[model samples]
Target: MSDIISVGFIEAESDATKCFRQLQYQNCPRPGAEVEIIQLAFIILGLEWNVVDVEKEYGIPPDMGTQINSTHWTGMMGLLSEEKITMVLAIYKIFLDITPERMKSVLFAFPSRYFQTIYVVRKPNETVSQNFIMNAFPSTVWIILAATFMIIWLIHILHAIIFCPKDSSIKKVFYQESGKSLMQLISANLRQTSELNSTGSLFVLNFLYLLAMIVILTYYQTAMFSNLVAPSYYKIPFRNRNELSARLLEGKVFMTDIKRRRPYCAYQCGDLYKALEKNPMKVRNTDAEVFRDISNNGVFQSKLDVNFIPSQFNWFSKRYDKIIIKDNLEVTHYTAFAFAKSQRKLRKKFDQALLKLLPAVEQITTAHGYRTRRRPFNPIQERHFFALSIREHFFQVFLIYIIGISLAFIIFLVEIFVYSKTFKNIATFLRLKT
Candidate 1:
């Protein structure tokens, strides 16, 4: 066993690096080194250790052998070139911008870990009623259906009104009955069939009425069932950067807030950064600003764009359902332990220790509880699990219920016109009670 070597670490406040700042540093000496999952392995491997505050001793750029902290893709290259620390404890890959210098400067220890990233989206500002109205009566399909039925009904009613035989009270009564029945059909209530008393067009009118109604009910039930059975989802999910750029060029979505945020990988990805910067997406600083555009109908407008985000933050934002990860736009950056050019033996020993501990570490941490493994990663989301509600799914059903109530009201109006005697009788009974 080598003597206690100085382990240097960078202190970052974000959730990604918070694990080292909290768990590992707490067990180590005062103002200890930043550590990662590999720390447990280092301890069990029987390696003596001394904590070195890299930030204070060497600075981020590392003045002497004191600093070993660099989280950037190329941070290790600069530190190793200067012979600051013998190895890097935690270096994350932003992208493989490797050059000849990196090739010669360091040896990589084994056990690279991967992370999952997702996009966060704002919620739509739609009420339950609005959602029902929007989903039930889709413009393109519903308008065409309503218009087609209206034209057919128009021809039927006009024959009774204008083209009826002159001096026929029966025809006049027929027109009134037909108009009232048609109104009920518009309100989407099909139980008014027994009230039809027109002679010639009775069978034809009933057939058309029921047929058009069947179409409407079929569509309504299908939509409601789809909403209830399958999970509610947006058809167009947020895709890769290229897809976003295309959407912007086509003016499908505009920026809402684009003040500087955390490191956006798109800046390193390609032309997407420039394209978006030309008309960068705007951002919402408050909840009201974020959801302002969502109130129009139930569909949330594509307002903000997240270029780079960790999965924990994305989950904590609770926008996973609305904004999805770019499944096809998988940009993975590799993270590896870094060792100095002369420390091949140490690097080889790290691989052996890692092989013995990584699987066990992952299992133990995961078994302790999900949060333990990802303790510092998504602290915000984990704490608020109790705040979740079924309303996220039930909003669709709630909207449908509101529609049903509105339809019932319209049907009530039609009933008063059709059954004038019953309403008058109720009024008289109410007066007697009063």
Candidate 2:
């Protein structure tokens, strides 16, 4: 037994020498010297008595002195370089001694330890967490949707202002008639010439321009309101129009009235419209006033002459008996993206990061009480602005066409007059020469 145990130090020393060579150390210690140092360290550590006792108890082999001496060098060297050796030993100790439960606890407690080390090695440039990068920043899909809509609206406005006939006529009218010095014949007739014909066309052009501007502005405002403003104001968590409409009809939640009178707990604006349709009440106030009345009255009550529905009610009623809360409503799903700054490389990185994290975010959100069936990324639904409606678009286009044709006619008339004046001047010059 003594002979067998005495050879352990020699094996340890051999392994150390092998490691040193593999690491390409400039000045490797001799195995015998390392073993001597290890033995001294073990003695200091109070293991000398245990080693001697173990040797005596194990067996008898007087020739084991040579093996023991050789092995001593390996153990001594390991003890001398205990700092690095201890770490490696500790890993093995943990693997052997640590229970599965305790290992789990350690891992949970120090999750960031491993993550940060790996992050440093793999992604030195990334300081932000994946969670923040994927969730906190705007998504690329959303940004694209927003930008696309903005560009389309901007082009529409530009087309109306620059190439639209209504705008062109206004410019022509101002250039030809407003700043010109008029002859007595023209000046006398100008006031009598029923300026309504020309002035009306100009007025129509101006109206179209104003209308176009209003439409563009209203569309932008509505988009912003649905996307950002309404969310902040209503605090409704519905993802799409259907959900929103259902929430409204549910009649439990109140739509926010920032300024108007507060409605009843059970009623909404939709209910009031229904009540009014069933029996038109002359509430001496304007539409705004009607809203005020409903806000003050918490419940809709049928009076002999007037029926009142609370402004807070969300139910829809087409007729007295035909009241149905709409379950389906139209909603738009817009895609957008976000980034920390305008970094070209980071944009791609961000996109890849988002793709990886999207599933995780969705899982987390679902766990946190978000409705899994509802699409949370859809844009909020609201009433479309009148100007942005299809009818308004067509009307504006027709008005522009009429204005363009009228302006062309006026320009032709001006050209004819200028030519006649030039011809007269030339004739007078020829007569004088003759």
Candidate 3:
């Protein structure tokens, strides 16, 4: 009986394990049937197999020790180097850094599916300014808009004075209340009914104001809708590594230890890996610990946390909707089985068998969900739009409606008080006259 080791670091086993497990259960495999690679490879070579899980024994995933000059090797790679096991069942490319020391120690075989490393971070929230309505447009645009209103008011005043009746009083012609005119002009701009009836220059000015108002309102509404839907690109503190690095320096954000581990970092991450290593405070021992901290911090503080994880379909589960998975930042890598250097003949034989069973292995990978599944960098999905209650979408509209209704009620009360006082005065005068 050949000893095939059960070696999976993460929650699930690699596609190879599924291929072998499938073969063991069924004599004649169905189309697209999943099989466990290592055990199936040995079984096809006419050998019985026993399984052992190294991760279970050590309470840690395997690491393909670093460099040629490194004295120590550990985990599944260490076991393979000493020829203690027949084969490491599910050694991923991430766990094995292809270095001179590692290459000399173990022979990689049965090249499996490719997967990518992705950086996940909390979606940036749109923090609306206190004066958001005014801030919607720049100072220049607001100034121009205000000037347009003033010009329209001035045009009306000029027309009223110049075209006044010769028999009319000065008070009726020149007594243009500036405040009332300004309010009416504003109402007209808002597409509301206003007392701005005029002709000639005043007419042309109103026409111009209407055109300008259309443009300004269109732009303002679009800008507001965009901001409400998603945070602007400039407002999003970090999008890529360069921006994240800047934020890190300012103490606005920090990266998790998920990708900072030596095996995972390799030569791909470069400076970022070095930065992570220097900061021990960023380390979270497990995935749950890392996720829990990020979830807790996200609820209370606006501090955006960055984490590197492999792209998988299951990531969408739990509180992961708030975590934005960046597709642009995806780094692809292929996975394969690792074997002892002494077992080159066995590796060659297994490789041949595994090649013949590649279709079956791929089917199992898909069935077991080992394929690369990514949630594209979409603001709506990251914000969990579908998960939100309907009330959230219309909250702003409802709030405005409530405020308007309250104001109308207050105005009604004030009118009642004023009318009641006038009626009482009239009745008293009538009684005194009688």
Per-model TM-score on C-alpha atoms: 0.54, 0.16, 0.58
Q: Which ten residues in a row have the lowest lDDT in candidate 2?
A: 112-121
What's the distance in Å from true for residue 297, model 3?
A: 4.5
Ranking by TM-score: 3, 1, 2
What local distance difference test score does each model get? 0.50, 0.31, 0.54
lDDT of 1 by residue, 328-398 (tens): 35444334566667778777877887787655644443343222221112211112122223565456567
Per-residue lDDT over 295-378 for candidate 2, one digit per residue giving the tens place of the 0 to 100 score:
432112211100111222222223221111211222111112211122234335334444444444333323332212221111
Q: RMSD of model 2, in Å?
A: 31.5
The alpha-carbon lDDT assigned to residue 107 of candidate 3 equals 87
Off by over 4 Å in 1: 1-6, 13-52, 60-76, 91-101, 117-134, 157-189, 193-202, 211-263, 266-271, 281-314, 317-328, 363-434
Identify the leading candidate in terms of TM-score: 3
> RMSD of candidate 1 to the true fold?
10.8
- Evaluated against the true structure, the overall lDDT of model 1 is 0.50
Task: Please tell me which model should have the higher TM-score, number 1 or number 2.
Answer: 1
| Candidate 3, residue 128: how far the Cα is off, in Å | 12
